[model samples]
Target: MSDYLRLENVSKTFGGIRAVNDVSFALKQGEIVGLIGPNGAGKTTLVNVITGVHPASLGRVIFQGEEVTRQKPFQAARRGLARTFQIVQPFPEMTVLDNVAAGALFGGSPEGLAEAREHAHRHLAFVGLDPIADQPAASLTLPNRKRLELAKSLAMNPKVLMLDEVNAGLNTGEIDTALDLIRRISERGITILLIEHLMKVVMSVSQRLLVLHHGALIAEGEPQKVVNDQHVVEAYLGEKFAKRLKEMGHA
Candidate 1:
């Protein structure tokens, strides 16, 4: 597959602090890549820079062979770069269907409300939320809310979807469901950048893994190899536990 998204020496700074530093990677078309790191590892900051929530302080953000280092969030969406937040925030007063409809409209689709609704319902049904599409967005449970978020993002008709902790709050069963949904999405030929902290989830779902430590890309390769790297084990899994797992021939 071709490189659909690329970040070249990207860095993001806030005042005196550097949140992301010289991080660079690429996402191939139709592949699911996992971005994993410990808390405060600047994972979200990198995504922000890519989607234009915060432009990179240095380097370029390229998508589909074009430089978009300074494009705004809406522009990113219109360009088929879509992302889900770590915290799922839906339009509180709107019905679930309408919330997704808003994504289709604002995502740069030239469709009117009627056409947007038509698209939204299909996405909602795909995410298994069509049963309660008329309910207020605020009324759904946590798992269903996450599903609604996926539906909203899908309604945007993304070519590349960056999922930031989409399974953050789910139970084991819910995570299984979410995993299935992600695989189905990938089957539709959408490239996925999954930002996750769960080792089992990332390892199982990712075709490749990128590990970050202190805002730097510490490791990137096959999932097992990256996880076994001393830097990744030390920074993410901690030295002591990694040693134990290694001793047991598990890591």
Candidate 2:
């Protein structure tokens, strides 16, 4: 099967600084890939380039066999790509359902408000936010707000979903809940690229792992192999983590 998404020699620069440099990878359809790196690893910058929040300074971003390197954010959305921010940004004044409905109305192909809302309701249910649908978005807890973000993105009917640190501030139970939701999403045939700091969460959910350091691709492979790689250890995981992993028999 063809790659569902491909980044070829992709680079993004802000003035003289290269936020993403010479990074390339392919995401197969229906696969869950994890992207992990330390702070300032350019992970979010790479996501911005892929989602068209920032255009690449060089190279190509191909999606579903088409070149979308310079597409605008709305254009990318229309082409069935969706992303959730690390910081959830809901329309505070709107009801949870309405906020999600807006995504269906604009990002997807819903015909009218009624259809959009119906789609939104289903998405909210999928993300376990249906009970709070009528509540104000601002009233939600952090975990609920994260679910709201996922619901809003799902309402877009995206073929590829890019999630940025969706489990950042959650407790163990909340992270498990998020992991289950992510698994359900992948089971529905949506290709996922997840950027997360939680090692256990990423290790458990991702079929493959991609590591970035100093704006470049450091490693990419099966989760276990990639985590145990010497370069990956030195670049991101550090020696202490490697020793701990070996002690835990993960080596």
Candidate 3:
């Protein structure tokens, strides 16, 4: 695998506070990389910087060897950097198909609405939401709504998909289904950056892991190794537990 997306010394500041601090990493093509951190660790901020929701205060974002640090959200999508929001917010009044069609039309750069809707149908089927394509987005259950979100991103023909807390509100069975969907999506050659809190989900799905704390990249390596790092364990389990693990030679 080769580097598909690279961030060089990325940092983001909100007023006087730094939300993302000199963070740098790369996503290799056709790999699923998990980004884990405690709440307020600026994981989403890093994603925003990559997707152009918030331009990085310093450093660069390179995609397929091209610099895109200043691109807007729409431009990010058009460049095949698609993402799902932690909060699923589809247009309530529109049919689910139309909502996904909007992504295809606006970001996928299809020739017209007819071609966009065609792409939407294909994506709906991919996410197992084809049966509910005509229903209003507001009517679906939470798990189905989450699947709809995946469909919308897929409709954009993403090369890299940043999933922010996609399993946040899912039940065990729903998460299993989602895991399967993610694997299937990966099979299509889309690189994934999964920002998740669920250890089970992240550890199981990720090929590699990146741990962030206090807006900095603290650990990056294989999942088990990263999870056991002193800084990562300390960030999640507090210094006492981390010290205990160190004493036990588990850190």
Model 3 clashing residue pairs (backbone): none
lDDT of candidate 3 at residue 79, scale 0 to 100: 96
Candidates' C-alpha lDDT: 0.91, 0.92, 0.91
Query: Highest TM-score: which candidate?
Result: 2
Candidate 2 residue 100 Cα shift, in angstroms, is: 0.5
Residues 2-47 of candidate 2: C-alpha lDDT, one tens digit per residue: 8999999999999999989999999999999999998999999999
Candidate 2 accuracy as TM-score:
0.97
List where candidate 1 sits over 4 angstroms from the true fold: 240-251
TM-score of each: 0.96, 0.97, 0.94
Q: Is candidate 1 or candidate 3 better by TM-score?
A: 1
| Each model's backbone clash number | 0, 0, 0
Q: Give the Cα RMSD of candidate 3.
A: 2.8
Cα lDDT, model 1, residue 190: 96
Query: For model 2, what is the alpha-carbon lDDT of residue 109?
Result: 86
Best-first order by TM-score: 2, 1, 3
